[model samples]
Target: MAKVLVIAGDFVEDYELMVPFQALQAMGHEVLAVCPDKSAGDKIKTAIHDFEGDQTYSEKPGHAFTLNASFADVSESQFDALVIPGGRAPEYLRLNPAVIDMVCAFAASAKPIAAICHGAQLLAAAKIIEGKKVSAYPACAPEVKLAGGDYADIAVDDAITDGNLVTAPAWPAHPAWLKQFNELLNK
Candidate 1:
């Protein structure tokens, strides 16, 4: 079974974090969820971002996600793949030096990385998206462009895989995103 590392923080998209974490575990993979400056057993408040016929997504309080591992204890060599969930957390996580470095490490190692929605912010901040094809929430197009990545504004239900990186616009694309990541890990 593949050992996966999930990076998340306060306000991480509810389904984006929980779905993949549980689904992967159900598939016989061992997943360790973590957050910067947080230790094992620590919990981070998550938010539900759902489209409610509005111009944008609506946010609501979600479950408190518990970390099963410490961010500081993670090593690129210890995991088979990485998962980055979206939401308000990425906005600040992308600014964290440790988070940026860890992301860069994963990219440098060419490990399978699955990022959804605003999670692309960390890829952009890590400067690893250059010349890569990526997809993310529409609002992240500018960031992808600025990062030298070719932003594919595909449907929210679809996922795009470029090399070892898998990206999707939002949680709505969970099926595709997780499937692609699963294939990559199995490779």
Candidate 2:
């Protein structure tokens, strides 16, 4: 089983973070959930983003998710794959130099990387998606393109895999995202 590292932060989409973390474990993989400046047992608040009749997704307060590992303890080489969940969190997480470096390391190694929705913001900030076809929330398409990536305008429930990276637009694509990511891990 692969040891996967999930990088997340406060206000991360509720289902995007929780589902993968739990589902990966259920699939027999070892998963570690972490947040910047936080340690094991520490918690981060989540938000539920739902699509309604509005222009954008609606946000509601979600559960407090506990971190299972410390960000400072993360060593890129220690994990086999990386997962980045989408939400308002990525908007700020991209500003952290350490976070950018970490994402770069994962990309440099060609390890399996799964990013969804606003998580592309981090990939854009890291400047590691150049020439790759990446899918993210429609709002993030410009960033993906500006970062030199080919934005995949895929269905909300679909996912696309390019090389070692597997990306999707949102949590609705979880089934396809995880399936593709799991295949990459097994390879």
Which candidate achieves the best lDDT against the true structure?
2
Over the full model, what C-alpha lDDT does candidate 2 score relative to the true structure? 0.97
Each prediction's total of clashing residue pairs, residues at least 3 apart in sequence or on different chains, is 0, 0
Cα misplacement distance, residue 166 of candidate 1 (Å): 0.1
Segments of candidate 2 deviating more than 4 angstroms:
none
Sequence-dependent TM-score of model 1: 0.98
Candidate 2 lDDT by residue in tens digits, 1-187: 9999999999999999999999999999999999999999999999999999899999999999999999999989999999999999999999999999999999999999999999999999999999999999999999999999999999999999999989999999999999999999998
Residue pairs of candidate 1 with colliding backbone atoms: none
> For residues 24-109, could you state the per-residue lDDT of candidate 1 as single tens digits?
99988999999999999999999999999999999999999989999999888999999999999999999899889889999999
- List the lowest-lDDT window of 10 residues for candidate 2: 93-102
Candidate 2 TM-score to native: 0.99
Q: What's the residue-level lDDT of 94 in candidate 1?
A: 91
Q: Which stretches of candidate 1 lie over 4 Å from their true place?
A: none
